[model samples]
Target: MGSLAPDSMVRRVYRCMCGINPGLEAPTASAKTGAFAASGVSREQLVIFLADTLRGTAEERAPLIMAMSQCGTEAAAAVTCEQVAEFLRDLISTVIQIVVHRGRLQGWQPERMGDGSLGVKLLAEQMCSELKPSDQGFCDVSSLEDFIFRVSQISLYLEMLVAEGLNVSLSGRPTPTLLPPCRETPWKELRCLLDLPTIMFLAPQLPDRYSAPWRLVFSTQLHGESFTRMVAGLSKRGPTLLLLKDTKGHVFGGFASHAWEVKPQFQGDSRCFLFSVLPRLRVYTATGYNQHFMYLNQNQQTMPNGLGMGGQHSYFGLWLDNDFGRGHSRARPKCTTYGSPQLSGDEDFTLDSMEVWAVGKPPEPEEGEEGEGKRSILDVDPEVQAMMEMAGKTLHSQGLREPEEEQEQ
Candidate 1:
């Protein structure tokens, strides 16, 4: 009989790979060799097999890392794309044999690099890929491209989830929640600083709670509305995230447990915090003392609307006054109310770009939880707590509900 077609071979390998469980280690060499042999694909054919199978690198990092670990190869050292593909094929077929035929998960390990740094490897819970069905007979060029794009989107979204520390170990194995970033846009620099993985680790979603996957809800530049007007659509959504770029090239924003409302009073609980994304990814959760300190008031007619960036007083103000060209606000930047590394506001910088996203779910109070609200930081620095004391007292003492909206004269 004729040898199996290249696509057939790839399907076989993919089937084997899918069979491997995330919790197991890589199979032995002899077993791997035998699987490929059974598939009728020689060593020379591995590259062609891989080229015909996988595509896209930006979101393929997790799968590639796992494959390399199983094959006892490392990608830490500079390697060509072809070499990486070859490595994946070798591991896939071997894994298929061990997991499918033998009915066992691959026991994968991180590679030890030349400098002794442990190479990147996916945790048992993080190995989620939604590639084309392995059993599917054949794929056309357009179909393959479409497949790669979908996979890339899934990978990007997963990375964002992981950044929020949603990966929890269950049954002695880390299990990540089911889900679903790369693209060119104005927020690139901000996102780079606010790395998705870091966000996952720092601000994880609460357990058993419903949180809608984050989606870009508003863009001041694209929407061409004042911040107050933009928030109209966003306020109705669940939790909210605000990302801003000042004219000075500074990128920062805030995460609020409360909606972006134009109430004439400060109306958020302790779930509001600020962050700076350009210099680095750091989150400033509520100081707790300022339980009701967030507000959105339309500033004086010419001055722009006022946003309480959350602090003791109204320190961290992100005003969106006039619409400056090129995705920026004409309002001056101000210092953050309570961010770790204070976010300084500059009057010189117009709003560069402002993006608002509706996060998964609105935070709910739990019995004996660290605090209230999902965005509430369980751990607070002693210094920060002490500093915020006076500010907290001020908020309580002064009836600082909302900034006075200019009366319609």
Candidate 2:
């Protein structure tokens, strides 16, 4: 019958009403009320709740706007306007942050600032009115168009907001220059200009009078279905030829060969073939193949011996000659050649000559393989030949020669 403590009395009152021990309950209501009080919502909450309810009932923007405008009490309008102004300020700040980040505009330059013209002053006025700052007042200026345009380039939403505030019509046309100047040029463009496609196209052609001792180094790593498809494609495009350089014993020699092989089993409806190399892992092609190989061998570093009927050699030549000796060449079985040589257990050997062949001619017809009136596989295509001639002329005008032309003695 003794009087209960304040906490126990509150619990007893709660339990009596809800038929549950209030002592076991979480302080959810108290926490919510505390937050609401901290935010000074005691007077504004009812007004906001009523305004929200009225807003929900309205089907169109006209009714909602009219209701807000016609609110009876000054306190209601003030609260609602304050909330709207805060929302607009937050939205504007977020948009500005996004624009700055995407445009990569870190520091401001005074030179780039637009003078406070009539258009800019008007925009500032609208922004200030919407944000309702106490100390800072909005101004009107003529440079608003430039500001709106720059921000628009970064974010369409920001553009729309600015347009709405300025009461201007927006066209869908894209203005690339309107973007901040930071993204005008990208690093990738320079890289693409120097890529393989550009280099091959720009390379000079070998002169008809010059017969250079040249070797093609086609270094590649293609295998499985992809290799077969590429080989087949290359074969159909033109004659398939394999230039093999073998060094070492016949059983365990280094074999590097390039061929356009065909694979009929590809799933795609279009016939797919590829240009491939045997011992498929060690083949590459490019404009710099021969020069790179020669440089490596001359330096006595381990490299591929890519000399085609010439004196070019790889770093691995010495080791192969010593350990594997010379093996029969695929092109000329009578001529023994050393394949790619390597230093025994040397990891410093670099394969700089590994690249795809930029240019290749068809092979001459063998003596017994000729058919009546059939052109040899080695016969040059008239179109291809003409293109090569044109390319050579262009290169001559540019004072450059094909890599093969440079090797001519």
Candidate 3:
């Protein structure tokens, strides 16, 4: 999509491919595209010619080109006929629907975008002759551009997926549950604008341990108490991401490198950082900031009944109240305050929304760390575990797990 820079397209595609098959090798175009050979054009020539048309300083295009090259290399190494077909089928279907939905370009009317999207309008007209866009007699130029761009880049990605594979179809490969889409909001759209260098710098800073797929597990507004419970239950298992939206529409959050604790002392490593979403994505590290109170805690004295963060007092970071909408705010200068944008104590004191995400899988066991025993579901406090067991039996007696656990049994 034109909304996405060239580098973003390459990264998303590459990331998706890697998620689909982490071990996939890089790829190059195969000789089987006989049409090119028949036309006396080799892949190298086509690429060089395309490169000539790309307008930018060498430095500007280098990373994007490098990403594209990497995608091709991976595609060439482990592509299969089935994988290519599946990828293409899904891409075409998705691109078409996405284009038809957005249907806007540079705020221009359909009659003005020229012949690029004429086919799109004609098809829409067939479905509903009175539709606003169809009535305008103009196709959406913006959506069309997105369509073409996505198609071209994704096609290249698909080709990479099946670069040198034999044509064959097997029926038994288990399909994975698609990763849930990231939260869609104004803040997220801003995050997409980060450039390659910034992204590279932030990559390792992410609390997530995995490089490829990350899924959304909780949104305060959507999940309510379940959200708090899930965090309290699982935060210690891995890193967690917190995103908060203030009353003024400012979006920012922190990463907790260690499991959250309700204790009064600051916790977590330097890997913990704070970042802002709107205006632009800028990350602030804990290197020189106050480190004593950049921690997550939960207790009654906490301004709100739920979860809150700060150095010692509830002066910095976000505070998500238990009742959902009432007690939330991001204020003052703490670990991320020195050079970062300061939130107004008055305007941002009450937040609009809050979200939390569990980052990456639990860390793998490292050398000599195997002796440390992790707290498991059964290891919860004796009284709590006993209560849970009683509740489990009660639910079972009521047949709550009848059909649900039957399949597993």
Q: Name the candidate that leads on TM-score.
A: 3
Please report, as a residue range, the 10-residue window in candidate 1 with the lowest summed lDDT.
112-121
Q: Per-residue error at 108 for model 3, in Å?
A: 30
lDDT of all the models against the reference?
Answer: 0.41, 0.25, 0.41
**In model 2, what is the error at residue 61, expressed in angstroms?**
6.2
Ranking 2 against 3 by TM-score, winner? 3
Model 2 C-alpha lDDT versus the unseen true structure: 0.25
Superposed Cα deviation of residue 183, candidate 2 (Å): 6.2
Clashes of each: 31, 52, 14
**Per-residue accuracy of model 1 over 62-143 as CA lDDT, tens digit each:** 3333333234232122323333334334332232232223222122111210111110111111212223322443332233
Candidate 1 lands at a TM-score of 0.39
1-409, model 2: which lDDT tens digit per residue?
A: 0121223222222221221112422111112211222333232333332232222222211122222222222211122333333333333333333334345232222123222122222222333333332233321111222223332221343333233322344466442121112111223311111121111111212221112112222222221223222233333222112222222211111212233222211111111111112222121222222321111111123433222221133222212221112322221211112223222122222221122221233355567764334642223355754676777743232234222223247
Residue 67, candidate 3: alpha-carbon lDDT: 28
lDDT at 81 for candidate 3? 28
